[model samples]
Target: MQDGLLYKLAALDSEFEQIHRLNYETFVEEIPQHGENPERRLVDKFHGENTYIVCLDGEELAGMLAVRDKRPFSLDQKLPGLDSYLPRSRSLCELRLLCVKKERRYRKVLLGLFTKLAAYCEEKKYDLAIISANVAQGKLYRNLGFIPFGPEVGSDGARYQPMYLTPESYYGMKERTKLLSRMDGEASVSQKHMNLLPGPVDVSADTERAMAGTPVSHRTEEFNEDLARVKQILSSITGAKHTAVLMGSGTLANDAVAAQLSLTEGNGLILSNGEFGERLIDHARRWGLSFCTIEKQWGGRFSREETEKALDKNPGASWLWAVHSETSTGVLNDAGMLGEICADRGIDLCLDCISSLGTVPLDLARVYMATGVSGKGLRSYPGLSFVFYNHEIASRPDKLPRYLDLGLYAESAGTPFTLSSNLLSALKASISNFSAEERYAELRKRSDWLREKLSDAGYDIVAEKGQESPAVITIPLPERLVSRVLGMKLERSGYYINWRSVYLLERNCVQIALMGECREDSLSPLIGLLRDEMKSRHRA
Candidate 1:
């Protein structure tokens, strides 16, 4: 929902009643398409089979349209042999009863209805949509990608031009609508707050320009070179011999790691102290990997003794997995110590460095298979994830899924399937100038300044001084104040901070992630805004 209006299928009894009344208002009184009803409500003849998509403004129906799949549709009555007259489609549907309230016409009621209808059709696997649109609104239909199919048809004084919308037209219109909506949204966001969310960090101007450049085919030599460069840079950063880039989020990379672990014979131990570590449990379960978890309190650091205890419990454990930087709690675990423990036990160690990859100094050379993403510490657009492994993945099991199979990805030279050239190029540009030591130092400086200032302001820090990551800072909200409420207030005041996750919201915690493109000068004002907001909330 947006602009104080909701668009969805009219499923409830009250909603269906509103649809009937709206039908009467539009067809009976306004358009004269139906006979006058004493009840002031007109139900369509195919109401039993029709699925109405309605837009509501604060419980009041503002606009609606009906979709039906039954034979002898309204268009069939006007234009005989409708299928013969239009493009051949296996799964066809008819749309009718399009109407909007007079006062709400200025709003995007029609567009909302169209969007809902499009989603509904897509869900139902509809290939084509036919509409007998009012002749006066022909231009509107055309603009919506509905092509006039046959001769204008209908009874006198209420003639309609039959039109059909194919999948191609529907998708094209949807993209255009999305582009325009995004343009408007970006303008509004530029004048308001800049987002500082962890995953979708603000992209730099050069990366944006790289993303905007003309796309190349994934199989072409140019795209292959770009993909190779991204993998090489990631390999260099992590100090790994090989890296495989996947077209998904960091979760996908972790899932691939889980899948790879499933191929191994013995049990594994997963360390958990935060949300990301917990998610790895789910991934392991989905992959059907036999593993035991060494659980710790959120924001709590893991010691070598704990790792040794978990290994001692699972005597046959073959690998150890843990998150380098627990983004949820701002806990930066000792991966080096954990690696040493695994090495002593003769067990391979896998790390989830999605949040720590470029934020801190990391050495993945000794790591078996570690996950990293293009966004966050990498300072690039999301949609690309990588798994860096020291071993030859081609020697792993061959029965794994095509997308999740590290061997398949490595064998295909990192372009296992259709990779987005734009995303690869943007990531390449981001990492081309990346300096691990310099970025880590800069982030450490910023984190130190922010932590000192925040602690001085009497905030409860989630992570202790020496144990915190260089790029993430978490603070607990005062008693009786919801983190989400304060987060929204900050957002409205031209600032955006991460909060509202179940883990954070339940504990009244808010996070300030220093991942994306940002500077020291920008931090002072942001810190000021946060300080003022907390003070105001304290007063309240």
Candidate 2:
């Protein structure tokens, strides 16, 4: 089983029996808090009124706690004057039945449970939490910010201490715990996904922490400084003169490029070889730009002859657009050739470098415009797209949508209205952690290793040999195998391989993206898993 554990609200009927059984195991058999029943389950008196918080170890009950605010709480019955025992509060609730399985006791089960419970109570507007803690774990309660109240109260040789934890106390104790953990050289255990997708990659601890920092207003000078740094980093990485950060997806960035093109007097040529390239055509059409298309089969490379022929055919075309790395087909188009052609012909070159921005080596000095996102190869979260241009695109069509206008974003220092500080901080952390050139080298090495391994395993690779992008590998499954089924199986095992999209399904392929937060050591294990999965499917 995966080591990751989940803390969530316990579902009634579905989880009641397990909750009762666990309660019996802890309160009756283990702690002797209740009399043993032949039913093998111990139902709490306030079960109906309780909101159960459960810690799950892959659908197995690992630990549980129940919270209730019904009048005359169990603690109230035990202590007549509960208000005097606890501090004054506007809203009060009692915590009960905190239990952890023996196997999971040493893990962070209690910590996770308490974290969820604290959030739940706070959301319900509970100012204070009262609990009758078993005297055996008194130290744990005290460590969790629960203050001992009144005297001990119990019956039948069972003893308990009444304790209360206010929101302030809980938060204060959380800070103390973090500080102590850090002092003790203990790091927070991450339960993040092993992200192998093209976007929203696996975030490093530093990036996560940066995002968790206090959020600031986007209009502040502090945020603008960070935003300026981010744009500078992008420019440095891509060799673009000016980069604009917009709070949207890559499609929006591409649309912004199209919007800029709309301001130009000359028509452009759009090259389509895959989904994203076709989407650029859509963007151009939507922008109502007079553009001609040079369409090619998916996964096919654009030859200089045909490209030049198309450009010659449309002498009025001032711009040539293509996806540098077609994400859907895993084909890395010949940008060098295309850029040279555009330069020789005095035509502007635009690229959809969303997937290649950091995963592949790029020098955008020759290109006039490009689109990228904070996610994908940049190793940051979604919701931020960047438009890298060599020259100023300001004052281009005042009729364009404000949000999609690159000039407006540049004028406002990348925050036209409101942007997310968390996203910006995370992007800064991601880019700062590794240089773009270093990331590109790593991706190339990993992709080569994976391709060699997959080839040895007899998988049919999509992009052929030299035409493939180092960032993504598309593998077509055999006739007997189902691409999406295997993809789902791998997903259940916490390994995400892109599959089942229209392009992939039509091609009977699944894609493995080698971008963003992927480690070299993880490549072999992933290959081994893929081999095993394929073998199993073949055997069946």
Candidate 3:
């Protein structure tokens, strides 16, 4: 058996036939059955119409099952005993023909399959699951928390138990299955099919414990002290003396910086290399700030000479805006170099470091103003952004708008304003995990490890080594596979990595960020899977 098995709804035609063959092998040949011609059964009425899932052990078939509305089975005259137990008015889903090969039985393939079925029932708002439990497998169903409520009956000369499971009981079983799946190394394998994939890194026990307390009032003095402490810690980590947390997203921080810093007599010089950089320009335009752009390709980086020339051309510019890390293309711009140039030219440097601050080394001493999010590199929940600036910018007595006023945040010491105490607690807990130097070292080590693993797997890293940010590693994909298809494949392998945008599809790039608790040991198996997938595609 393969180390991994992914389950997905089987499509029509060839894939459907493959699932039927696997079911025949498991249910008819290996398991005890009374149905005739079970070995060569061809599903006709219910084969292509209903929802069915196929389990794959790498590129090979493993098992399958079908689910359909329970009404048809409930109306059957031949199965009156089973029909009586099923609710007539309430909607129910029936599980049918669940099968697994003999070799894969010990791996709990049946349990995982049933767990998925239960989750599906709950998601589809089904009231109950009505099934005719096989006589030989009655004990297994009972162990799975299925209760036999109706009278026993004999079918096809074989005894069977009528069992049903409620939605609540089904979810209770799902929770237990999730716990067992984690222990059995199947949680990671099953995560590929989920929509919002959970990261491999588990939150620290200390952080979890810290977040267990009750929420506090953001307007209170105690909350003010807590907010100040968090800001001081963030400042120490990023080498910024003045950091103010806002009540909105990172975009608000970016807009705040654009609003305040574009006060110069001339147009702002906006650098466009990726999505975030382009967004800065958009913010500037919306605010009606005079601006000019020094545009580059998505993955392209600006050399010191090119930057100097751009600055020289826009000599009247008072502010230069850029993104430290472009999340869209997984590109990290040279903030330090850009900061120095802006300072030299008497231009205030405003940076969008939303995705870079926690994972990448940053110094606010060089940067005039910057924006960061509580999520992303900070590893906290979303809904807050921080704008860090020098005292000179904060002290500007321009009578700024109440919401965009940096002075209000500074006066309150990042509290007394409208803020979410729960998110603030989460941020404080997330930041307390490591010291500044420790976080920098960890980010660099993890990024380098992932890059080395992908490189050893015969894949090309999108960003050049040494110049890339420690937050994410982007890979240039093979020509044959599109980003969407590759994303679906990797998702099935239980690793949820980001793909480059549609605009960068021509570049054939895929990105993996080091945000989760993925270990070095797991990388080998993941690489092996990628290799096998690519090889199979070539053969096809």
Candidate 3 ranges beyond 4 A from true positions: 1-25, 28-117, 124-132, 138-212, 394-399, 413-416, 449-462, 473-511, 521-540
Q: For model 1, how does the per-residue alpha-carbon lDDT over 186-256 read when each residue is reduced to its tens digit?
A: 33442334566777888888999999999999999999888888778888888999998899999999989
Q: Between candidates 2 and 3, which one is better according to TM-score?
A: 3
Question: Cα deviation of 117 in candidate 3 (Å)?
Answer: 4.3
TM-score of each: 0.65, 0.65, 0.74
Tell me, what's the RMSD of every candidate? Answer: 13.0, 10.0, 6.3
Compose the digit string of candidate 3's lDDT tens values, residues 127-194.
87766677788988876767786666655544567777776665576577665445335533444332
Deviating ranges (above 4 Å) for candidate 2? 1-193, 536-540
Number of the predicted model whose TM-score against the real structure is largest: 3
lDDT against true structure, model 1:
0.83
The local distance difference test score of each candidate is 0.83, 0.82, 0.69
Candidate 1 — which pairs collide?
A: none
Instruction: Mark the 10 consecutive residues where model 2 has the least summed lDDT.
Output: 183-192
Candidate no. 2 TM-score: 0.65
